[model samples]
Target: MSAGSHTNEIPRHRVLAKVEGPLKPGYETILTPDALLFLADLERRFGRARRNMLEYRQDRQERFDYGELPDFLPETAHIRNAMWEVAPIPPALRDRRVEITGPVDRKMMINALNSGAKMFMADFEDANSPSWANIIEGQINMYDFARDQLSYTDTARGKDYKLNDEIATMLVRPRGWHLEEAHITVDGRPMSASLCDFGLHIFHNGKILAEKGIGPFYYLPKLESHKEARLWNDVFNFAQTFIG
Candidate 1:
């Protein structure tokens, strides 16, 4: 479907099961119909490959368990020897001397962004509890942060919090491939937590972040091999094209 046509009227054929849980207030802001459509599309396009890659990981683990040693891929010797450099770093990420990371929560996010660090990575992986509430609320926190509308007030502590005028560049780290988001399912199977996290964030914030001259910056985690990284690159390219 055309990007412009992805509205609240997501085609029934594309709908996954409605996210299962007591979705908290403001959850609707991030879990809109169009956003879910975007996620469904991602699952359709890449889900099989994700599953296969996970299986390959298991196979490798079995081989290692049998005492087979691991080494660099002979197939990529040319790539190893070739001179190359990644794309130029985005302006906002160039001076990342100090980067703070933490799980997503309003007060912590506010502090992390305002910390004098050059970058703040809001983690949905190891640092986070993967409860359904945490997963969905993390997305909500990111949405508000991207729009400069994130703040927290601790009435009992008599403290108020808001972003500093010059806040750190925000980056996101999705959950690893080994994890599944039980709360969101596609075609009756658990959704890849990595894709769910990545898709929702990018679909909701990609353009807005671009307009702010920052980015859809990401910190990929728990990749076991070059193949996994390649898969992620493909996912990123497809999402970029879809959004455009």
Candidate 2:
């Protein structure tokens, strides 16, 4: 990447963002200027640490492949010995006995939201195709889902899909920290898929969902270390401060 990679293509008034993938019709709604700015902000704030974390994962994997056995780290003995308590579970999340999960396809998301499970996990990582259209349209679906106005028409089957009167609590599962969202780039580097997933949904719908008693719940997958988890915690804190 060149020093002027981002500046060369992006307008001065807008955040430095390069859309490498095809932006189909209506994708602009989800990839708005404000939302891309939010993503770029996240990338600027934590992108380096995220890259380091991925590099650490690779190093650990290589060591394991070379016959290095797993053992407790002496440096983290205090953490292992310390007695710690987690924050109290929120009332809305106390009873997550069952959660149904699927890709973030429009109709599938509607069906998952209306499923009888206690929670619906709209997965963007494992269960998704990760095509540009799938990812962007999924964001659109999430925005509408949070607003409780998500609907889909099966024109061929002549059927419509919508949320039920009583629906499950919703949770988003972003792509792992290891993944890169190749569609959009900040500073000529592809944005972290994790940030892209969490940033877009939270930037667009965090407050909307909060007003409905759900505080932008998420299920982070494939975290390998405390530092990786710490990165997410920092992202959450920064996002709250950014969007407050």
Candidate 3:
């Protein structure tokens, strides 16, 4: 839907993603039929809630602009004060003394993965330009990275690049819920950029990474409230069950 469009009028049916941009060479592997369908499923399931949350964010910002101050919600104080422990840190992420982050371009991915840092975060959010070429190619680069098949050659400099033997553990940072992937639409509405980035990565590489003893990890960005965080947690749960 365009800005200010009616959200409730949208129909729920067979979910599909129509590519609105040029499908370049080597993109078919990343934008595979199955992958697109998986993305559609994600959008169909959670896209509306994401948009609602974004609306709430805007409304909250407007309130702040009108001199409203923030405060902790008393309604959830019980949970906050309750003693709880987070899940144990996975072995691959335990020693993160040095973590490097970079955009998802081929050269950058190869360089960062080999940068000797304990963790390398491939950022698809603010660090990346959301051009059609960049978005699609980023998926391809990550797909290859997970499978240990990524390589690049600088034809100008005649320099070949490849992953080092002792490379950093990889994590992905998807775009926040506020953004839309305008290049792909489902039910005549653009899919969430967050879903596009996270869905594609998890669809293509989640199983592969799980087999490697470290499940797919992510650095979620720009969450406004716990509701948004819960949305992500729900997405994670749904994707896990769907993929399994």
Candidate 4:
């Protein structure tokens, strides 16, 4: 079937591996048929490059263990020497004097977003334990937040939480290149956790954030080389085109 053909079911043209763990209720809300197809398309488009880069990382690690030091790539010296600066910062991110980050649990999500800080990164990597429940629930929290409907009720504390009218500008940090989401798979291989985190969040929130005059901003982690950065940039470019 064509990519757009399977709207409410898994696409037959792709070979998706079975999820390896128990899927909790409400997971279907985030891992819908269309979302899976989007992920499958990403894997088909970029999986080989991702695998090759991972292999390169392993080879580099072996060489490092054998006492080979690293150096600049002679091939890209001109690009490196060229003068450059990033585009102007987005309006919401301009006053980045204070920023906070934490995992995407209910309490943390409420606190971090409501914190007086200028920005809050809903971390899906270092601060997160990467359990299946955590990943899917994080996505849900982000989806709700984008729509200005996220809230938390703390019966234990006899308190309720809701977003402040003026809260921190939100950002997301996906899992590193080294991690794989064991719970999600495509083509009989574990899906790239980075892709899963980045894709799901962006698919759900990009347009909404854009409409709000903010961003679906991202904080990428554990990039060991310029190549990895380039890979992320490519993904960002593709995502912009795809989302648009």
Against the hidden true structure, what lDDT does model 2 obtain? 0.89
Number of clashing pairs, model 2?
Answer: 0
User: By descending lDDT, how would the candidates be arranged?
Assistant: 3, 2, 1, 4
**Model 1: CA > 4 A from native:** 1-13
Among the numbered candidates, top lDDT falls to 3
The pairs that clash in candidate 3 are 1-189
Model 2 agreement with the true structure over 47-119: per-residue lDDT tens digits: 9999988899999999999999988989999988999999998877988999899999999888887779999
Model 4 Cα shift for residue 136 (angstroms)? 0.2
lDDT (C-alpha) at residue 126 in model 1: 82
Over 4 Å off, model 2: 1-14
lDDT of 1 by residue, 1-244 (tens): 8777656775766785458667888889988888888887887778899999999999999999999999988899998999999898789988989989999977999999888999999999888888888888889988987788888899999999998898899889999877877888887787788999999999999999999888889999989988899999999999999899
Ranking of candidates on TM-score, top first: 3, 1, 2, 4
lDDT per residue for candidate 3 within 106-211, as digits (tens), equals 9999999888899989999778888989989999998998888999999999999999888899889999888899999988898999999999999999999999
Quote the lDDT for 72 in model 2: 90
Model 3: lDDT to the true structure: 0.90
Position 106, candidate 1: lDDT: 77
TM-score each candidate: 0.90, 0.90, 0.91, 0.89
